[model samples]
Target: MSKEITSRKDDYSQWYNDLIIKGGLADYSAVRGCMVIKPYGYALWENMRDVLDKMFKDTGHQNAYFPLFVPKSLFEKEEENAEGFAKECAVVTHYRLKVNPDKKGALMVDPESKLEEELIIRPTSEAIIWNTYKGWIQSYRDLPLLINQWANVVRWEMRTRLFLRTAEFLWQEGHTAHATAEEAVAETKQMLEVYADFAETYMAMPVIKGVKSANERFAGALDTYCIEAMMQDGKALQAGTSHFLGQNFAKAFDVKFSDKENKLDYVWATSWGVSTRLIGALVMAHSDDDGLILPPKLAPIQVVIVPIFKGEEQKKAIDEKVSVLVKELKQAGVKVKYDDSDNARPGWKFAEYELKGVPLRIGIGARDIQNNVVEVARRDTREKKSYPMEGLADSLVNLLNDIQQSIYNKAFNFREEHITPAETWDEFVKLLDEKAGFISAHWDGTGETEDKIKELTKATIRCIPLNNTKEEGKCILTGQPSNQRVLFARAY
Candidate 1:
């Protein structure tokens, strides 16, 4: 029943680590940079996966998988992508292991079993997918190959966090091929909107939809559209990204199709993905020092009913009343649970659910049952109210909706306030150090200035917001001519 999480204000990093470990979401694994997602965390991911999978299907994407390892030659086909992920790639040089002759019973790689060609564990699937697309597309009719795969990827990150940045993580990647540049661009923008919608509606996290700068764009992408969300710490987290690949992948893998006009042309491509790192964004966006504060829409258990009783007779009475309420809630399409077991006490159960981020907790005691009332506590606001049990199910349903909106409004307001405009170099540096949120500033639109600013402040351009207003101005860092302001922030 005691709150043991580190305060976010005192130490944000430690607080995040504590919540993930102590809240039973995930734990550090035996592997250096991997993690074992516990049941509670996997349940959360399942709900997110179900919703996203349905969305992909509704948008005409079919689920299919490819090999986990890509041949070295195939991986090197896309030059830009190859260079971008080269350092993070894990390669299989030898296929077998044998006992060390010097140290009996110890095992070591068998130099004699070296592979003829090294295999690269996928950091992303563009190379392998495009290579296969070569055979799949022979005519314009097969231009749009909409495929999605839910898989695990490895990026050998030296510095890792529980869910934010790990060596291996689960994700859903969508790779689609189109016949024309315009169609592929449209697909890219469409997926960006989808990510923004998912973040706002389901996660109760507000995000800015924008296009990444040239230096920040995805490797081999002409343009990268992203949904950037502000964490509670005033830092930016890229919630999702959709890339317009033009004909890069097609040309790299020599994937071409005969057009309807009897002309041969390379296929255009688009790829977008969201990963388990979203779980980190969910925790940092709205969670407080107490624990995670999940939106009602995504909370695995929307309502948990705990009975406060002294003896078996009182417990049975409370259980009888809860059964009716649970049935009503389930009929209304609400995820509800009745905890009547004696493994834990009422206080312990209350604290446990609170830490788990359950949206609503209902208490049914002998007195409340006698009065035909129940005590309801909301996780977002921590407000408790006594409501009549006659129509409590409907009341709880409406309250859940209210909580979802309330959490979103709170996050939206926080994000709005954190965006500060910087007109001068000193102001930009001051804002970054003092405020630590999104700073709107004019850039020279050159990679040199972008890289210089990052070197000086460790802040990067988050995005050039979509539909950005046009105005002549000077770059805050280099005093070069500029047209519009882009968002800059220290990101995760």
Candidate 2:
């Protein structure tokens, strides 16, 4: 291989950095905190988008578009949201730029050109979207307006990672309005379930479905539900979130609808989204020392065929055989690629395909063809076996399905094993410092306790898991009366 990958053991962060760059997925851009997603990375995103789009459509959601910029006046209407995102917002203060008088081939912000009101590049589309929804709803008949938008958003983060915390990233936000608070809350949890299902089944990443604590909740939201996933390095990533905005945005934007009984009431709202940061979660969850090990369902190219040869005659023979296999696999509904490039040897191609995370690879040589058998390698387990050419297509289809399930099961098991329940402050602190995974502990249900825990350990209450039973006990830190246990972890 091209210099063995930085072992995950040596440095998990460095390993991820090297893999993203050397695997031909993405590159850092000229702009700080931004990245250029290459063809390979974009293809993977396309696969994710396609699958998510279908799920949204199947659930009675319609696609729509919203403006990219939110005027200062509109943004400030929701004070809580504005304050929450202000620290990370990109603002457009000037309208134009002109050539610098003292410098050659340089431009400067024109002093003469300034916008009437500075526009805040959206970290999320709530303010602008709610303002627009005000005009669309005048009566209860307009209730439950479920809409989703696929778009790019900008956030001026202090630190950025390739896919996790980039300044600009792609995501689909679902903004829905309902007539009743109950309906809106139900919509929020339902969407959370959707995200969990997508993560576990499609991405092959197991997640814990739960509700965020008040301190960890989305700003201006009554409740926030999330799907939290664990990475191989024992860190946690919030895979997706769904928030129930109970009359917050509606009151901010003056979105009121008249009921059938002539009563005017504010609309109830819910907003949920899963961003491209999911790509990072996928990498950290399943990748190994060699390279990425993508789930078969999410892999852009499910299979790659490498033809081995020493001469023109052997090349001709392998090409013919590959052509037949390609046609058969395609007909069987498999995403397959025939790589006959003479620029690289079979061994080199093997490592290349593995780095790209193609789930299955087929290798054919003159002897193998003569024997009516071909060697197949799996990316997940790095296992190779020879199989007869007759039923090769069927075998590959089955193996891909198996890989997808196996990855999910492995992650699920890891998550199950790391959940530790603590009853004392010392134990909790020790778990946060040494274990570095999810810690379940009793809380007094006060924001003060949550904030103090974060101040002391830099660990936050990730969530209060769904269906948690209430048990009378003392708080882990305060030794005060408490009712239930909440999940804690240092999150991404």
Candidate 3:
């Protein structure tokens, strides 16, 4: 490797920071808590968005846009949500900037231009979206209005990382209105499964599908379903969340629909979202100390062909072979890049692409061209194999798929190995401090115990496994009788 990254074992956070900048993904912006996602990073986001947008459309959701700023009055309508997000909101008090009369070469907020009510930049679109849904949903026929919006949201965070917890990030929030509670809950879980499938199949990150506890639920939601993925550092990241909002938003906004009998009732609601945070999850889940290791399905450039030459004749010959190979790969629906740039050496190109996480790399040198073979390298394992040009396209496709499956399997196995069941409080605390993965411990099903555990260990109950067994035991902390074990981990 020409340039090495901060090893994950040395410092997990440092490794993540190094990977994002070194991999050509993103960089910190001038603004505090914000980032500038570069072309490669944006391309990865586009791929994720395109696939998810299709999934939503196929499932009967239509795209819509909502205002970025919410009136403070409208935001306060939902008391619980307002309280939950109050500390993290960016408020605009004035609309104009004026030249500072007391200072040279400076501008400041015009005190005279302050509005009657402050505008809160949306941390989420629920308030503004629900207020608009009030008018669109006046009858039973409009009860199930499925809408999704792809937008950037701002959350004023005290500390920020690139995609994980940036002040501004891109995400898709799906807000739907349903007539019945059962239908709304079902929609919530359905979208959770969609996120899980996308993460596992496309991003090659395995996730656990479960429900959030009351204390961990979405601000205004009745219940929250989530897909939690374990990062390589053994910390849990909530990859995505689907909220069964019940009638909270509708009630807050007075959004009502008439039933078959002509009785007016509030609409049941569901809101689900997956953000650029998934990009962070992808980085930590499979990337190695070498650099990023993008899954083939989501890699912006799935395969790159680097042609090597020592002379003009050799260059001509290699270019000819590369052109043919590129055509074949394109015909097979593979995204291929032929890198014959004279500015960079073969060794430099190899290190660059490895950092950028290209799944497959093909090197065609003068000697290899003579042998009618090209050296192919796998990003995941760094395994190199020389294969004859014949049937190379088909082999590349298979190898890409194999790499995808291999990454998922590796993550799945690692997650399984890290999940340790603890029967005693000492063991539970010890595991949280030492191993630090998913700790399955009986919780007496009390929010007080949950809060105490979180206070002491900085670990929350991530979820109660979907099909958890009813094993009679004592609460790891409270000593109260418990029926089942819940997964507890310090999460991102």
Candidate 1 is scored at a TM of 0.98
Instruction: Give the per-residue lDDT of model 2 (tens digit) for 148-183.
Output: 999999999999999999999999999999999999
Positional deviation of 330 in candidate 2, in angstroms?
1.3
| Local accuracy by lDDT, each model | 0.93, 0.91, 0.93
Model 1: per-residue lDDT, tens digit, 1-492?
486999988999999998898888999989999999999899899989999998889888999999999999999999999999999999989999999999989999999999999999999999999999999999999968999999999999989999999999999999999999999999999888888889999999999999999999999999999999999889999999999999999999999999988899999999999999999999999888878888888888999999999889998898889888989999999999998878998989988898889999999899998999999999989999999998888999999999999999999999999999999999999999899689999999999999999999999999999979998999999999999999999999
What ranges in model 3 sit over 4 Å off?
Answer: none
Q: Show the colliding residue pairs in model 1.
A: none
**Residue range 168-280, candidate 3, lDDT tens digits:** 99999999999999999889988998999999999999898998899999999999999889999899999999999999989999999999999999999999999999999
The lDDT of model 3 is: 0.93
Candidate 2 residue-wise lDDT at 272 = 99
Write down the lDDT that model 2 would get: 0.91
lDDT of 1: 0.93
Q: Estimate each model's TM-score.
A: 0.98, 0.98, 0.98
